[model samples]
Target: MPERGARDLSPGTQARFDRFSPTGPKTSLLTVPGAVGAEVAGFTPVGDVMGCVVHQVGYTETSTWSADRIGQLADILRAGYQTALDRLVEEATAIGAHGVLGIDFTITSPDGLVQEFVALGTAVRATAGPRPRRPFTTGLPGQDVAKLMLAGWVPVRVAVGISGRAFTDRWGRPMVNEWVGNIEVPMATELATAVRTAARAEFTREIGDCGADGGIVSDLKFDLWPVHDVAVAAMATVIGTAITRFREGPVAPTSTLKILPLTRI
Candidate 1:
């Protein structure tokens, strides 16, 4: 049993726990300009950790009218990204880290059929006490983590959402009550609605898996293009770190009084 404090750890989680954790009790001397040391806020940097995965992209046929043609691509992406995330967690856990901060994710298409995903971050542990059985991952920098801790909240993990979209463009006719000769372009209202719906649905599902009650979001991105000239594809990817609120917002900093220098009498 590691002395770590990941509460609510299930039997499955414990089974996978390392039988032992080596004790170094070392401090990270690495410094960032304008950033406070981890020790000042009761944390110790374990090391810089990373994880990566490469997945082959399946070929998809194009269709001008059907959007479901590329739904399977979404599933493939989901699996690939999730694998990368899992590997990242394993690395952080191996270091006996309580959480990861300043996480960076990278995506590259090594070839037409193969894509790679990489996760990188600095791992750290709380010095004041044991951390949760499972450490959290975040894109937040070390300074932000320290500041948030003072406010009574801890980052959980990085959440990701991805959705595959396809659309067709064909202004078949005008779609407005023209004042005699109205020439308003028809709105792709359904396409717009579908885009939001699918992307958000994918994002919501990804965050749900992290068990985060509430958190911040960022890096929501999209890649849209037409392949084979018959169908348009929209690939939306959103990234952010999830957080768990502490019992209360950060405690108010204790006040200190410094008597002004006495006037020379």
Candidate 2:
């Protein structure tokens, strides 16, 4: 009888690879200082803290399945995690945060299919001196910044719009219909300027109306449509939190602040 070919151990071996593993050394954990309950216990006033969120490019089910077939699903998932982490880090850097605490991650799917990957964290300046090792707990009625940390969440909305037209410029190149052959300035410039101005105003107005301190502008989309005429339409959005500061009571010594696991409490 012909010798049987070597059995395929790849599938069996590959199954083990699907398990999730920590991307890097767990030495980089961060947490917000102060007792979450203190804000509500009349111990300390709630201060405004900058927040930011970031998402990774979504992968289709097909891509994910294919990665599994190639025994690369772990790498793909890790890549997604890193992408989100990097985005949060970039935002923290922009805010001049010494360290980010209460970091969280979340995975969302609108139709039961993985639709988005998100990362979020509070950007805060750490108190000077050696950091405390554990979180203290106290009684409060306000949101617990530590417990409310979400890993995968989309940011609040800010609106943006862009518009443009195509015609031939003074240079004889095809451009917006109304413009002469390739004019010195592109016709789209006018529409762009108008839309940009409107977008900024709208963002400011929205934030003010919502009682938010500030918002992060992102995913500003610009689209050029050739409908009826070569008119362009652009859209953009901002994501952030509407924060309200409140003073509870006098700050206390030996305030017990509890750092709960990152999740909705």
Candidate 3:
């Protein structure tokens, strides 16, 4: 047997131990953002985040159902709707949003087992300040100046997809086509919801990391594609500019700001 010492161990054993142990210097836990830091500091906010939830329910058809069973069908529909809404609300609460806006719900069920449901909307903090109004100068000619007005932000593209078992029709007929057309509406809505959620999370993370209040989302677009015959994928991108505003007491002569026009003649 080899002599045992505090600093002496088998190379393989040491390596394995090191691999299993957490590595790197321990960092300050208070530096973590969101609730992590709050927990460490033993502080809690006065109110909960405000947010909205949207729910979509897909159609379901059963041969056993008759005109007499319309009440049962309605009950089933209500249950599905509530489930989707609850899910959306849960997600928004997790992210600490103050409230949700424009909650939209859609449902489409071409087949019984493949019901599609979607809920979406904006999540915002009730305490957050209103967006500042910035006057944009339009250099249109006098002849066209009267008709020109600032247009609200618009998303350039939106796309969504889902992947899973193949969908069937209301009559329990499996769709032979690789693509199901009836699902487009609900799928798209849900895709938009997910994309927007991701985008907002990213924006919030960036704001916290950079010590900024908030940023605007513009030129947003969404894309959806099929990963498999049954699996779908969706993405949203915001390519516009983000501006950070600071309180009035800044005196930095060396700081340079750049502004670009959206259009040029």
Candidate 4:
């Protein structure tokens, strides 16, 4: 077995041995605060859990588009995210954890050739009994999960939708030269709509694969920047925590209405 500790992949005999060990990193079973830490209703935290993946970005043409994939940036992003998510689940399961709460995801490029993605959270167990078919993953805090549980919802997994897109200008189109008069540049509008639709569909498909009803989608994030002065490329990201209905249970007093409304609409 490997000794669990801070894994820096450092240069030393002990580090080398720990890397090969079957066990996960040994983190102090202490309390975590903020979004990554929570005080839920029905679950207890065991320890801090983490899963890290360093992937070498596969080859992609910088110029032309490939109908199979590179043409669709969302596909490439999905592949990377899926692999990282799988690793995170594996670590939690290894420690016999029921689920992970308030999972925080981070990504960074090490050298422009490889990218590193990390998912970290607190591993917890149900206070009642064993977990469902498998441990669940959620981006929500522990308190939220507890409230959700009371409302008959269980988080299935953390889900995301991402898109990388660019559009080419069709010079001949009269709309392109809106300066001539007053006209709408339908090209940008159409391309933007198409790209966003595609990304959303891909995200829904992923959540479905987790064998759940649906997920709670947070605000969609967008990073739209210009690619030169001619074309535009945008990255749209949506982060959410997938959830499904558990048996109906009692809600907390806070879950109920506090004050009665004076009038009804």
For residues 12-98, write the lDDT of model 1, one tens digit per residue.
334434333455343332358213645555766776666777887765544332455456667767777677777767766765788
TM-score, structure 3 vs. true: 0.26
- Cα lDDT for residue 156, model 1? 78
| For model 4, the run of ten residues with the poorest summed lDDT | 9-18
- TM per model? 0.70, 0.28, 0.26, 0.71
- Per-residue error (Å), model 3, residue 179: 40
| Candidate 2 residue-wise lDDT, 14-132, digit = tens | 23222212242222223224444223222222122222233334454642332232223223333454456555544443323443443444546566434355655444433443321
- State the displacement of the C-alpha of residue 24, model 3, in Å, after optimal TM-score superposition: 25
- Give lDDT per model, in order: 0.65, 0.37, 0.35, 0.65
lDDT of 3 by residue, 1-265 (tens): 1122344433533442243212333221122243332333223222221112232333435432222233343344444444554554443343343333334445566755444555444332333334222211111111121111111221111112111111213353332354755554454456557656765565455445534334444344455544323333454443221223433433436855476667742
RMSD vs true structure, all candidates? 8.1, 18.4, 19.5, 6.4
Winner on lDDT (2 vs 3): 2
Q: What is the Cα root-mean-square deviation between model 2 and the actual structure? A: 18.4
Answer with 1 or 3, whichever has the higher lDDT. 1
The TM-score of predicted model 2 comes to 0.28
| Clash counts for the predictions, in order | 7, 26, 20, 2
The ten-residue window of minimal lDDT in model 1 covers 26-35
